[model samples]
Target: MVQVHIARSGVQLGKYPEADIPVLIGAGTVRRTDHYWKKGMAYWLVIGRTYDPPAAAPPLPAASAKPVPKPMRPLRYECLRCGHKANTVREEKPGNFLMEICTWLANPFVGGLYTITREAGKKALCVNCGSEHMTEEVW
Candidate 1:
């Protein structure tokens, strides 16, 4: 029995028994252009020129892939500071007069723009303690 060493570019892939060569090749892990070396070989040679097999066969079928399930996203906010079930609030702020006036003076088209804000998108104001902070977890 002879041992064969496989390499790609200049990096050695591994040393394996001669029997595994065809399987590795058929499995698509080893390519034809990859270099091969054995005990009697003087130098590394390409697998395509050196390795003689009956005929090229189709690659072994890989195991069927199963879809990975995604993690469930949190639906509600629970206040950490006061331990209260928090509510989600969408807050819109009216345009600031100062900014509006400045923008109006600068350009009327841009002056009418108001700041679109989600002030409490993920944050909750505790009804018990009145502390405004991010919720600890989903309600």
Candidate 2:
């Protein structure tokens, strides 16, 4: 199922009304490209010109311009030192922004796969080591 991320609400709308949503000239979503669709996603919804209310209705409430929460992919990586947990790389789910931090550095992750992080300074060492010399920064 395609996840419909509400950009204004920061909510992940995993459930769609159906397999495909009708996009018009005014609505906020529109199909932008066909490249990924060929990759075998269940569905997709791209944002387009936002639809507004008609003149007959009352003024719409002011909604906070919060960013929507995109779908997150599972990730696993071990620390090179002491064999501990390290940073997680979560891929962007179908029909969402790949730029989201949660979706960054992700590679088509699957279960039962493990790769320890490259060896670095003591700062990158695992918590079990309790190293005194530490430099803070994942990069």
Candidate 3:
């Protein structure tokens, strides 16, 4: 049971069994450029030069065998007032710098909670006319 030391990018990953090295490479855990050192070797050597994957070894299984989900059509938006059509909307929120500073000076704990809740509340506006009145169209 020979053990091999694996290193990559100047950092030692850990020692792994010699037989498992090829399995690691197949699983993407080990790369060809990674360095390895074992007993009887004077210095470290690139794994690509020393190891060759066995031709009889079974190929790695697919990461995901499930069928992929079909792509969804992008949401289309039309501004009711301006009659502008667009696929994107902009988020509108007022800056709370002054309020945040005042709250932080009073109590840092409360200020952090207030800032998080305030930032999470956002209003989406139509990109064309910057109006909140918008209707969604699938097609």
Candidate 4:
């Protein structure tokens, strides 16, 4: 392979393989005004005039092909308190313990249903140690 020396504004950018010249042009690493020369050449010339690179290969046709769907991801989070990874505890509203116990005792079934249905929103609980503060782990 022929080795070509490249220069920009009379400053040398070092020598590179002739085949890489096209790649450098495609990647915008070299400008059309950049100068090129080889051992046999007496002087540098504008790369655009010195080299005639082959045209890029055409992209394949998409004919009747269905796009692949991305896979579903599972929910994962870390407990801020215990640093647990598996399960998360649900956060509950703060209230008087005595009052809450009395209310639960009055109607255990209804209280339990309400407790189950309560929303935690963005907050998560650590299931390992029942911690309320949870940090979500981005996949």
TM-score of each: 0.37, 0.14, 0.39, 0.39
Q: Which pairs of residues collide in model 4?
A: 88-125, 89-125, 89-126
Q: How are the candidates ranked when ordered by TM-score, highest leading? A: 4, 3, 1, 2
- Estimate candidate 3's alpha-carbon lDDT, on a 0 to 1 scale: 0.83
Model 4 C-alpha lDDT per residue in residues 7-115, reported as the tens digit of each score: 9999999888988888887787877799998989998899984555676679778787787877756557777788777633565554444655666799998666545
Query: What clash pairs does model 2 have?
Result: 10-68, 10-69, 26-50, 26-51, 28-48, 29-47, 30-46
lDDT of 3 by residue, 20-109 (tens): 988888888989999999999999999994666677958888788778888776668878888877777786655577888898889999
The C-alpha RMSD of each candidate to the native structure, in angstroms, is 18.5, 32.9, 22.1, 16.5
What local lDDT score does residue 82 receive in model 3, on the 0 to 100 scale? 89
Worst 10 residues of 2 by lDDT: 110-119
Across 22-120, the per-residue lDDT of candidate 2 in tens digits comes to 432225343322111212446433443222223366778878878888745332344444454435322223222333323334542411121211112
- Model 2 TM-score? 0.14
Q: Which candidate's lDDT is highest?
A: 3
The per-candidate count of clashes, in order, stands at 0, 7, 0, 3
* Model 3 pairs whose backbones collide: none
For model 2 the local lDDT of residue 114 reads 18
On a 0 to 100 scale, what is the lDDT of residue 32 in model 4? 79
